[model samples]
Target chain A: MNRTWALYKKEVRSYFVSPLFYVVAAVFLSLCGFFFYSDLNFFLQFGFGMDIIGNFFQLLFADMSRAMLITVPLLTMRLFAEERKLGTIELLFTYPLREREVYAGKFCAAATVFLVMLGATLLYPIHLYTVQPYAFTVVAAGYCGLLLLGLMFIGVGLFVSSLTDSQVVAGVGSVGLLFLLWSASWNEASGSDRVMGVVKAFSTFEHFSNFSKGLIDSTDVLYFVFVVVFFTNLTLRSLESRRWRGRR
Target chain B: MIEVRNLRKQFGSTVAVNDVSFRVQTGEIIGLLGPNGSGKTTIMRILTGFFPPTAGTAWVGGLSVEADSIAVRRLIGYLPESVVLYPDIPVARYLRFCGEVKDLTGNKLRERIEAVIEAVGLGEVRHREIGKLSKGYRQRVGLAQALIAEPALLILDEPTVGLDPSQVIEIRNLIRNLRGQSTILLSTHILHEVSLACDRVIIIHRGDIIAEDTAEGLNRRVQGVFQTLVRVDGPLPEVVGALRSLPGVDEVIEDAVPSDAATRLRIVSREGEPVRKAIARAIVDRGWSLIEVSPIQLTLEDLFVRLVRQQPSGH
Candidate 1:
């Protein structure tokens, strides 16, 4: 556990030191601010009797959810790919820590960065609160759902990064993969419901929808956790396979 | 201590390392000398627990590389052939990170990082970003990373590959200074580097260890068939016949030049023979002035070439 934290600290520090973290954070915050202003203007023009905080959050959640499918890949593309390219992967493997510890350390660090980005978007709610004191519970729940969804996508990006040594390839490949998972339920034919049911079950956005609607379902939370764990396990296995394949 | 038995690694149908085995006692510097693609890095990777052998097993510090890889990894520090670091990071911060990965923290981590930085001569550029440093400094940083943990075993694969002449000398001196404190297994194709730093040399070719002995031992083995060049003022035919009849003389080949004021005769002798003295005596007995009698010495390059050429016989 000490080794895990050591790795986590180093990884988090590395993210901050590199330009990727700052660039991604700046882009994400700007997009969130733009979406929040646009949503507010739409609510004022429509004179929708519904709560503006809830409506703005719903819009923020949807836009950020899609934005995450893009930004998560950028965040995770260099996690393993840059390590391999820079020959630090071999150095890391020589440490006494287990593969699981390394995986968890990096996973938590990237998730933390994602959470921080999401946290910055809280300004939209604070602004809404100035106009009308909204239900803080709904805002909190929506943020939780967004975080969980982002965590799942980050896992997918990390797994993709482990598959290749080129950061560009990892980044593009992760975006393509996340896009597929995000839109898995696009086909809505009568016979496609059966397929959509399974797809929706695996869709990261589907699991997040319940949370955005101010509902906390244990099953939905479990789905996100299981997906994160499942992909992280796959990343570990991929690293282990390199050992047997004698490519290290 | 390190022990490897019948280690083999195969990538698909091609064998990268085949039935390779060797051992290193504590405080001994061993060199794994091989040509390109001769499994030097593969063996190092397996020994360091970065990877496992497809067949056979290896133990480092009494821990199995396959079963107790984490424990084995703790005992070894590895420097890959191409040392690539995070260029954006400051040198000191990078070393601290390495210390952390090796399970050192708090005061211990700080002390170790400072010690390694000083040991590798990175004090001047400790705060500089790695990318801005020169090649020599970058190589020093790589060395510092390996030595920060101060493991029982250190594996360096072509550590001096891309360095300039002076940089190579500095790195070599650093490695030489690490002789007794840490057991080292360095791989290189530069024969002189092995002769300068390693106590025992293992020469591998085509995924097999063809020669394993001390530098002197390898030279002695290759020098078995001694050749002496004698320049004398005498009859070439008579000198050749007399040298051939000697007990240790295997075959004497007469040069193209006829016997004159300065005639050169080449004499080949069996192993463990001092043919120079016998040739001198024969020339003196015949009342001919022997101008020069020199026994040819086989250098490490000659030995490496002979060993590599002989690899086809599967020795």
Candidate 2:
């Protein structure tokens, strides 16, 4: 197969082989299940007079996004950091493959595993589907938003992982950066209108809101794409800088 | 094939490699000999396209390392010092992974993997986790990983550093078997390893290419630091003065093992000067029975120390 695909397979298999993957996935799934149950329970309790279905999804996805913002770093912390700490990045960099291929392969691999983790939460919706009819279009839109948001988070996480050989540092740095990106607009009211607008536009939380409401904005889609591409490019350059730093 | 032109690498103020240049013909095994911190690893890194030189250029397989690094990397199979493998990955699977990264696939990848596995004598442990293997086995696996891609140039930095004596011989034999297949540039301070395995030795001291010659040629070059043990049947002071007065002779040190009849003198010659003929003649002229006059054959170890001592401090 393709070389990038080979790396992707190795990365994916690596996750399954390590206990860290199972622990992280199990904890993430348990949290999601608890949130899904709470959302469903609230819908069942206070549903006689309100848009319970919409409320259920709004809470579910928002919680999923926040949980995933935290979870992405845990999964991605080992991508480049572990390879570097183990000195296997030397092997990877010595290969004929371009730097971008390595970054893309790793990003795609982590995204794939993230998708698998996200896929587990689909059981909740599947259960909901069997009980009461929900708008398929709306669910698709929410998923598109969730996938894009997760991709951006993965890109950022991977980039952070490239900066250090310590996985803990990558993990903590990614969480802090993701939190900043997610809440950049939180204090915008005190700023000038133009500054507030810029902050809101930059905030991932702001961009993701429309998607959770089943609205597909091309601007939001482009924003996520931009984040992924930008961070992946940075990761490519990060690998190049390693040469200057005499890491090999 | 490799050619480096006036390469220089500076890490901040400390110059790691200084104005070093060399060429290697295809299929020649060149041993890069250097003391620790002698910049051998840095040079290998530059050649392998792991990093660009702070100045100068290198071409591997006719591809410029700076402009065509990916292509240069394609032609090189590099085993860095202390080969690090993924602890969790099995040897066979890891090799296959590396092969695939080199764009090998299908039947060719499988065949090459099999070949390198047997070549490195890692067939038995191919299915074991790399972390669990012995150092020698891990080293073999490292070699197999580099060999799997079948590149035109193989750059191995201290491939046998931590192995036992028998393992060292095994790895040396493995490298020997690879001759004529790929141009191999291996770096090590292990002198005997160069003498046994390399066609030529490039001695780098203080980030400089102090000497480059065949193993025998290097021995001869160090032979310039002339030291010979002479046993003469004569008055000790007379023999010492006559040997010291001889042309090209620098000093005459008497052996501490006091001899009753024969005077054992260690004659050291001036640099780049051979004093054997003069010392032999002087002893004959003095009517002393020249029992023995043999130029000390400097082992690579002594040669390394002698060369190192001749150079000023690196810093």
Candidate 3:
């Protein structure tokens, strides 16, 4: 645990010192700000009555999810890829660090950066609350769902990063993978009833929709949990394969 | 202390390290000398617990490297051939991170970082980013990180490969300062470094231990029959015949056939014994003015070439 924390601190320091992190943060915040203002405009123009705040929060969640699908890869593309490219992975492997600790430390560092970017979006909720009274339950659940979704994206990004040494490849691969997952719900339109149900159930978009509507289901939570664990373990195995494959 | 028994590593069909085995006592410094692609780095990687050998076992500090890797890693400090480091981190911060990874904390970590920074002369650039430092400083930082943990065994692979002449001397001096403190196993193809820094050298050719001895021992091993050059101001045939008939002289050849005012003859000895004195006496008795008579020094390069030729296939 202590070693993991040490690696975590080093990783976070590397991110803050790097100019790329600031670029990523600036771009993500600008996109969030643009989405928030548009969402506010839509809410003011069309939401005259009938739970305007809940609908407004739902729109913001949808925008945030879309923004994260593109930006989370930026945050995670360098996790393992840069280490290997810079020849520093040998340093990590020879150190007294378990493969899991290195993975967890890098994962938490990227997630922390992701959450900080998410934290910037918190001001949007405060703006909504100040305008008038809003449902705390809907907003809180919506943020919870966003956090879960972001965690899943981070896991996927980290796994893709482990697959290659070039950050370009990692970023592009993660984007392609996330797009495929997001588009899986389209399969529901062409399948039989039973097959459609399964497709919708497996689609991350379908699962995230429930959380956006203030509906908390264990199954929805389980879906994000499953995605996070599946990719996290895959990243771990990818690292362990370095030893098994006997390269570097 | 370290031990290996018949260690072998194969990358697919290519055998990297084959049937290689040697030991380092508690405080001995052993140099691993080999040409490029001769498996010096591969053996160091295996010893450092980065990967297990394909067919054998290695032990470091009395523990099996394959079985107790974490424990083995704790016992050894490694500086890879290329000096792998985080280029963006400041020198002190990088050392602190390595210290913490090595389980150092609080006062101990701080103390070691300060000592190593000063030890490697990195105090000037302790706050500088490693990438910005010159190659010499970067190499020093690599050494400092390896030393920060104060492990019992230190493994340095080509510690001075890319440095200029003076930087090489400084790095060699720093390594010399570390001589008695830890058991050191350094690998280099530069024969001068091995002769200057290492007490004993293990020469590997194509993944096999070709020769293991001290500098003088290696020279003697390759110089079983000696060659001496004698320059005399006399007739070429008289000088060659006089030198050949001398006791201990195996054969004498006219190196230069009556050029200018002198003739040069190369005399070969029958055994490892000295034949120079006998040749000089014969020249003097023959009334020739001998200009020079010196035994040729057998260098490490000569020994390496001979060994490589003698054992064509190291496997």
TM-score of each: 0.87, 0.87, 0.88
**Model 1: which residue pairs collide?**
none
Better of 2 and 3 by DockQ: 2
Candidate 1, residue B175: how far the Cα is off, in Å: 1.1
Candidates sorted by DockQ, best first: 1, 2, 3
lDDT per residue, candidate 1, A48-104, as tens digits? 787754566677778878777778889999999988887778878877878899888
Q: Is candidate 1 or candidate 2 better by DockQ?
A: 1
**Candidate 3 docking classification:** medium
Task: Please give the ranking of all candidate structures by lDDT, highest first, separated by commas.
Answer: 2, 3, 1
lDDT of 3 by residue, B1-315 (tens): 989889999888888998998988998989999999999998999998888899888999889998999999998889988775888999999999999989999999999999999999998899999999999999999999889899899999999999999999999999999988999999999877898888899999888999999876787677766777788888887777777777887888777764445787777785444577777778888888989987665777888898788785525
Model 3 score (lDDT)? 0.87
Worst 10 residues of 2 chain A by lDDT: A46-55
TM-score, structure 1 vs. true: 0.87
Off by over 4 Å in 2: B225-297, B312-315
Question: How does candidate 3 fare on TM-score?
Answer: 0.88
lDDT of 2 at B205: 87
**Cand. 2: chain B TM-score:** 0.77
The DockQ-based CAPRI class assigned to model 2 is medium
* i-RMSD values for every candidate model: 1.5, 1.1, 1.2
lDDT of 2: 0.87
